[model samples]
Target: MRQSSAVFRMIAPLIAVGVLMVGCGPSPAPNSAPSLSPMPVPAQTAASDKPLRVAPAPSALTPPVGSLYKNPTNNRNELVLADVRHTAVIIGDSQAMPAGSWPQQGVAALGYKLHVAGMGGTGYVAGNGKTGNYIDALQRGDWVLPYGEPPLIVIEGGGNDATQHATDAQITSNADRLLAALKTRYPGSRLAMIGTLARGINNGGGRRTEVDALLGRIAAKHGVPFVSAGDWLTRYDAIGDLQDGVHLRPAGHAKIGVVLAQELTALGLAARPDSAPAAK
Candidate 1:
């Protein structure tokens, strides 16, 4: 499917984020809104390059500034705003593509709507010999912020770049440009970065590790939370979760969702619904 370079679109982040998966062939589902799903946990697997991060325990994080209140309509014990005003803007390449909607479950957990946009074969520095890179795509307005005012933003990429042997400078410069555009568009939103996925673990080894490190440095420079996938293979038992090494199987997708939800909770990005009351 060839999209006009001038046309910008907004789809629920992973509106199915559907089969738009890079390696998997197919366009994303046409739906423009994301679906919400609960998060979960993955049975333990061999330790990945990075030790498996086991949350010590579920502790309530401090509320963001004001007193929280539970939405009277809510069925669970929680705190936050009653009505949802925030959106989670997620962008990436194939990894961000459809294989599985990695953002839906976690975004739902945070009570924010999800919006995703990305070219299946594109990334910051590579495009699988097709499509434009993230920087150019954003510059050309291939897609824009669909969710009105997003409180949280996530940028996922790097796999294609390393596989295609993108120069460090190319990756760095393009990544910088992409981040600039995101901040410019959603100045008030909190941002986070998810790095390259690996094959064995440690980002599938080789060049991917370098790419993850580079992306991490960029994230650190920008002061946004960064989730590295260098050890993802072992951490998530990716060998069984991946369908083709890059795209995920259903189980892989579920594990990723749970892990991401936990990270967002830890970051205090998705502590409670918008309507939950502040702790006494």
Candidate 2:
């Protein structure tokens, strides 16, 4: 009976240990409910739960101060005005570039800030190695257009076209494309053309004057205002103003600016009354 009792006690402890081990074993997965955690475990959200992102639209940049904006080849350029109500955009060749140019003087007199783009040897259909023609440059994004709707957009050039001997057909085609593009781009703006400056036939003018006249006809067809400087050298007796057979000196440009301003005023194309005149 004593031995039997001792054996029973030993077996009892073993059985208790086995029962405790079984109680501490891992539980099976649930069938219906998910396991609950006191602390949240960070899990990747579904794609739909994420906020949507979109790219920004393009917009114009305003300059804080008056300065020059140059392009890649330094062929195309802009004259930024710090505070301007009306802008006069001029696209041409060397004639439109330089400070105190006729276009610059005329626009300034009309109380508009000037934004001019031109290469030395480029025209409607003529391209220099560094830059393309006016239409080409505009299409290639060679120059940046000024922000807002310009009050006046002037197409200037044809000197290089004549010099390069581009056909009338080529000039007309390119000029038409450029005019169409400008009209489409700035539907609210007024369009005009400043013809090539040239002497009369008697004063050694040939292709240059012809191109100027041709441009006048194109402007008329498009119903755009045309200012002819074709006969200015001979008519105004300003041949002496010519630094070369073609280009004008600074004084000559200043004199021409006065005359051109007068002509623009006569055509009722001066700056709007709301436009603030640049400070002297």
Candidate 3:
């Protein structure tokens, strides 16, 4: 009985040790919380709350033809003569008063009465003097008739003078004296002296350049505008628009008229349509 009891004790201890080993084995690592990785974020887009959205691309604005007249009182639709007593004067040589004059066309288009006092063959020096016999019809009173109010005077000489071998000093001096005299005669008038057209041949005389330079100086001295007809006309010629080698064709004249009208508007000689607001 004692021996049987000892064997029983030893077997009991071995069974107890096996149960402990089974309990100590890994139990799914204690069922720990799942390790989560960081989630990726989405990209952002532009957003606006405003109702009125701006255009991606905008277009440029263009001004109307003959819409640059600087005159505050003159209306775009109405002729200057309808309101004023005197007429605008255009003085030039034959080319200026061509078969169809650009000045005349320009004035008419811009709703103005035209009074041309140009002598075809006369130069600035000759016109101012009685020796040329060009201004014979104009009496002393008529000399200042075109200037009671500030009139738009288009002076278009220099072509003849330039071609005639006039010296730079002579040309400038003549232009200066003439402009001074005109200013003295008519203080309020605005003068625009058109430069001479280009003569193709180099006559060894600097007449063409001299006349242009003098016109610029004269314009500065008189505080008036100077338009280079030669420059503009040459551009036209480059585009194959000249009838003769020298004179402007009808289309050319019209182009010149358009340019002149724009110039007139800029000079404050014409009025804008929407000058005064409506009585609302």
Give the per-residue lDDT of model 1 (tens digit) for 1-280. Answer: 3464323344545544564564567555895433456355454657555445566544553334224433233222222332225556678776666745665565556667666767777778886454588878666556544423356778888888887899899988988887887776556667888887775333347887778888999989877888776667667776687788677777777777777778777777774455754220
lDDT of each: 0.67, 0.81, 0.57
Cα lDDT tens digits for candidate 3, 77-116: 2112332333566767766666466766765555556666
lDDT (C-alpha) at residue 189 in model 3: 60
TM, every model? 0.63, 0.72, 0.54
Q: Using lDDT as the measure, which candidate wins?
A: 2
- Model 2 residue runs over 4 Å out of place are 1-49, 54-84, 275-280
Model 2 lDDT tens row, 146-245: 6445788888889999999999999999999999988876677888899988897677779999999999999999999999988888887778988987
Off by over 4 Å in 1: 1-84, 128-130, 200-204, 271-280
Q: Between candidates 2 and 3, which one is better according to lDDT? A: 2
lDDT score of model 2? 0.81
Task: Sort the predicted structures by TM-score, highest score first.
Answer: 2, 1, 3
- Clashes within 3 Å, all models in order: 24, 0, 10
Q: Please report, as a residue range, the 10-residue window in candidate 2 with the lowest summed lDDT.
A: 55-64
